[model samples]
Target: MELVLRSYCDLRLLLLLLGFSAGAVLSRPTDEGKEVWGYVTVHKDAHMFWWLYYATNPWKNFSELPLIMWLQGGPGGSSTGFGNFEEIGPLDSNLKPRNTTWLQSASLLFVDNPVGTGFSYVNTSDAYTKNLDMVASDMMVLLKTFFDSHTEFQTIPFYIFSESYGGKMAAGISLELHKAIQQGSIKCNFAGVALGDSWISPIDSVLSWGPYLYSMSLLDDQGLAEVSKVAEQVLDAVSEGHYQKATQLWGKAEMVIEQNTDGVNFYNILTKSTPTPAKESSLEFTQSHLVQLCQRHVRHLQQDALSQLMNGPIRKKLKIIPEDHSWGGQATNVFQNMEGDFMKPVISIVDELLEAGVNVTVYNGQLDLIVDTMGQEAWVRKLKWPELSKFNQLKRKALYSDPQSSETSAFVKSYKNLAFFWILRAGHMA
Candidate 1:
C-alpha cells in the first residue's frame, strides 16, 4: 500500500509540471496590445481630482519591460497633447488607431495630472489651486494607486519623461518619488528621466535666444554694431533697472528678427501666415480637437479658454499667476501668469536625484529662443557635478519627427549619459 501511494504522488507532481508549462506557453505577447484606461484619485485638499491614466503592457518577449510615465508640460497641458498626438499615441502615422509597436515594447503611461489639467477634475470650484509640490504629491498618490491596481508592475523599471514646463514638474516629482522610496512610503525600480526643449532655468535658458537669432542670420556683425550704436545705447541710458532692461533687450532682440522674417507670424515659425494647427488636425477627430484635449485631461477648462482663443487681445492680456494660484474661473491668464521662480528649487532637486542614483538628461532645441539651449549649458556648468569628467564626450546626432518620419533637424553633442543636444531647427515644441 505504501509503494502504491508513492507512485501516485510522483504522477501528481508530473501532471502539475505539465500544467505549469502549458500555462507559460499560452501567455500573452508583450508588445502591440490594447491600452488599459483607468482613473486614480487625488486626495489633496477639500476637493478630490479623478486623474486619467492610460496604461499598456510591455512589448513582446520582454515580460518585465520598463514603465515610462510621460508628462505634457504647460503649467496646464495634457500629456495627450504630445505623447499621443505625436510620439506614441495608440495610433499609426495615418492617425488610424492601432495598439502596436512602441506602446507594446514598454508599459507607457500618460496622466492628465494635477487637478486643473486634463480629464482629471475636482468637485469644488476651488480645484484650480496648484503648485509644483502639490502636483508632485498628487502624482505620488496616483502612482501608489497605479501600483496597487497593477501589482504585476511593482518590480518593473520606471522612468519619467516630459517637455516644456514639465521639465520642472518632472524634476520635482522625481525628487519626491526618490524621497518616498527612501522613507518606505512607496516602492519603485526607478530609472533615468529625460526632457526636451524644457523651460527649466530662466537665467540659463534666456541666453539661448541670442544664438537662435544668429542661427536665423538675423544678427550679423553689422546688425549687432547697428543695434549697439543707437538703439541699445538709448535703451540702456533710460532703463529704470534690470527688469526694464531685460524687457527692452528682449524686445530689441525680437525686433531684430521681426523685420527679417515673413513678419506675418512672429511667435511660431511653423505657421505660415495662419495660426499653427495642432499636429493631429490631419486626423479630423469628431469633437473639437481642443475640447477633446481638455476633456481627456483637464476637467475644469470651461468655455472661457475657447473664447479667449477666439479673441486676440484676451489671449495676450492673460496674466501670469503665482505657482500655487487657483484656476477656478476662465483660464484667461493660466499660461501667461507664470510663476517665474518655479525653477529655483530644481537645482536642489536634481542634486537630490543624482545622490539617490537617478540619471537625468536635459536637452533643448537651439532654435528655441524661449527656453534657450545656451541657458541649459550654463546651468549644467553651474551644477558642478563631481563626476563631470564623464560628460566630456560629444557627438552630432539627427533629430526626427517620429520613429518613422524623416529627419527634421540635426542635433549637436551626444554625451555618455548626462547630456544636452541642440536641435538646430526645432523650437519650444521639440
Candidate 2:
C-alpha cells in the first residue's frame, strides 16, 4: 500500500510505500492502494483531521471511483477511529481486513470533525464549535483545503455518509457544499448524502420510543405510559425553548426506559443489555444525555486498547499530530460545548437538500431504539418536499446482500432525489 502522510506543521505531503502480507479475500485490493492522512487548519487554533483511503479497485483508475466521506455522530465521535476501524474502512478494530469494507466500491475519507474530535484539536476550549453551523463552516474549510491540495480529486463524484449527529452535520454540509459548488467556490461533482440511523430529528425519535418498545414487547402498557410521560416532558422542554432542560428530560426518559426494560440496550433492542449501575439513576443531566448515550455506545473507541492504538501506533505512524494532543481526549468537551443544540431537529435541512435536487437517502435499522425506524418515518413524513407523497406511495423493494440468500437484508423506497431504506435486524450502527 502507498501511504501519504501530510504534516500539519509544514503542510508537506510525504509519500511512503508499505507492504502488507494479510490473507486476501474475494475482491480485496491486490494492486497498489493509496492512503492519505493529514490535518487542515479549519479555524484559529482548530485543526480537523481527515484520513482518506483510495479505492482498491485494481480494475479501474483511482480517480474514476466515487469518494465517500464518513462522519461519525456524537458531534464528537472520531470518524477516523470508529467509522474507519469499526465500520467501513479497510480494517476491523482488530487490525484485520474487513470483508465488508466500502473500499471495494468507493474511496473512503474519514474525518474527525468539529475541531476537537479524535486527532482534531483546538488550542483553547473557546475554539470548539457550539453549533452545527460552525461545524459545517469548519468542514467547508477542510474540504476547500483538501481539494486545493489534491487537485486530482476536484472533479470526482463525492458523497457524504454519516451516522447519528454526523448525519445532521452531513445534511448542513451537503447543502452548503452544493451552494459553494454552484457559486464556483469549489470544483467537484458532489453527488449526495446518506444518513444511516441518524439523529436528525431528536424529538421524533424520543416521542416514538414508547410505542416502539411496547410494540417490541419490551414494555407493557404501564411501562409505555411511564415512558410517554417522561418523553412528553422532553418534548415540552424543547417546545418551551429550554433546550438544556430538554436534554435533561431526555436523560430522565432514558432512565425511565432502563427501569422499564430492565436496562435494555439503546442501540439494538435485540442485543443483550449491559446493566447500568444503580447509582446512574440519580445522576444529574448537566450534560446532554444523547451525547452521554452516544459515548457509551462508542465507548470502546476511547478505551485503553483502541486508545493506545490511535495515540501510540496510529499517532506515531502519522507523526503530524502534536505531542500534547491525545486521541479522543477532547471528545467530552466537544459534547459539552454542543449541549444546547443537541435536541434541535435538522429536518428542514433535509427538506432544503431535497428541494435543491440533491440526492438525500435515509436509512434506519429496524432494531435501533435510538433513532428508531418509526421515528425516521415520522420525521420524513413532515418533509415539505413536493415528491414526498409520491415517494411514500412507491412500493418498497426488498434488498438482499447475498444473491443466494433467501432472507431479505433490507427494503428501500425512492422517488426523485429522496430515498429511504429500512435495514433488517440491524441497529444504530447500520
Candidate 3:
C-alpha cells in the first residue's frame, strides 16, 4: 500500500503546540524566510532534489534550530510534494500559509529520495536504487555535498523523520550517517530518527491484517478466514526467502481485503468507500504490476493538485529542476526497482540503532490499518536491545493537547533512548 512517514524529534510537544495555535495565522504566502532549493548529483546519472525552509520563528536564528529531513513512503512518495505541502511544509496545497507547519519548531528539509522520485531524476533506469543500502549511500553523498557547501548547518542537530517505507529507509540512512559522522567523512550533529507507522516489517503487518480487521468488526468469520489464508501464503513466501513471490502475495492479500471489506481504506480502517480494486484477470503480477497494485491502493495521492503546484510554480521558483523531470514522474520505477526488497524486515537495523545509543522514537496512529499498532508492537517486542524489558515494564503516560480538555490525545512510554507514542483518533498521516 502507499504509506507516508513523518519525523519529529519532540513530536509530542510539537503536536501540543499545533493544537494550541492551529489556524491562528492566516495570510497570503509571503517570502518564506531564506528558502533554498537545489539538485544534488549523488551518482553518475542520479540526481536527488532537496528543499530547505529556514525556521520562521523570529526570536531564534535558524542555525539554532534542529534540521528535520522528511522522507515520504511508497518507496517512491515525493517528500517535496506530499510531505511538504500536504503535511508539514510552510504552505498548504492552495499555496496558503500553514500556521501549524513544522517550521514553527525546526528547519524543514524535504528530499525526493532514491533518485527517481519527485523532482529527483535518473538518466538511466540502472541508476534506480535496488535496496535500502543504495538509498542510504546516495543520501550520504547528498548530505556530504549539502554540509560541505553550507558549513553553517554543520554543528546543528540533524534529525531524520520518515514514515511507512520511508522509515525503513531512514533506519539505513541514520545508521550510515552515524558512521560517516564518526569517521569524519560527514560533519554534522546527527541526532535521531522518528518512524511513524513504518513498514519495517511488512510481513508482520500483513499477518496482522485479518485479526485487526476482525477486531474492528469490519470482517465476518469467512472474510477473516480468506484473509488469513492469503496472509499465510505471504508468510510462507517470505519464510522461504521468495521475496518476489512474497511481494506478489502481499498484493493478492490486499486485493482480498479490499473485496471482503468493500474497498476499505488501507491507511485507516475507520474510513470507508475507498476506490474499488481493478480486475485481477486484467493484471499480471510482474515487479512493475506489483508496484502498480500498491500504488492503486493509494491512488488519491498519485495524481493530485500538489503535483501540479510542484511542477508549475514551485519548479519555477527553484529554477534548478531539470525541465524533463516532473515531480513524481518516475516514482513507479522507484517502487518497481524495490519490489524484491519490499518484504524484507529492517527490525535488526532498529536494534542496532538502539544498541549504538541512538534516540529512536516510534509512533503509530490508533486507526492506521496498513501498519497497524498491533504489527508495530509485534516487531518492537522482537528487538534484541537489552533495555527492552525495562521499557516494557514502564507504564504509559497519558498526553493531552490542551490543559483544559479532559480528553487524552495520546500515550507515551519510554526507557533510555527509545520511545513509542500511541496517538489516538488519528490515521496513517498523523
lDDT of 2: 0.80
Cα miss at 178, model 3 (Å)? 0.8
Q: Please give the ranking of all candidate structures by lDDT, highest first, separated by commas.
A: 3, 2, 1
lDDT of each: 0.50, 0.80, 0.82
Where does model 1 exceed 4 Å of error? 1-28, 44-62, 92-95, 98-101, 219-345, 393-417, 422-426
Question: Where does candidate 3 have its weakest 10-residue lDDT segment?
Answer: 15-24
| Reference-based lDDT, residue 360, model 1 | 78
TM-score (C-alpha) between model 2 and the true structure = 0.90
TM-score of each: 0.64, 0.90, 0.92
Using lDDT as the measure, the top candidate is: 3
RMSDs, each prediction? 15.3, 7.8, 4.4
- Candidate 3, residue 106: Cα displacement in angstroms equals 0.1
- Residues 342-423, candidate 1, lDDT per residue (tens digit)? 3243666766666666777776654455566666776677665666555654455554424355744444343433645565
Among all candidates shown, the one with the greatest TM-score: 3
- Candidate 2, residue 262: lDDT: 92
lDDT digits (tens) for residues 403-429 of candidate 3: 677877788897888989898877788
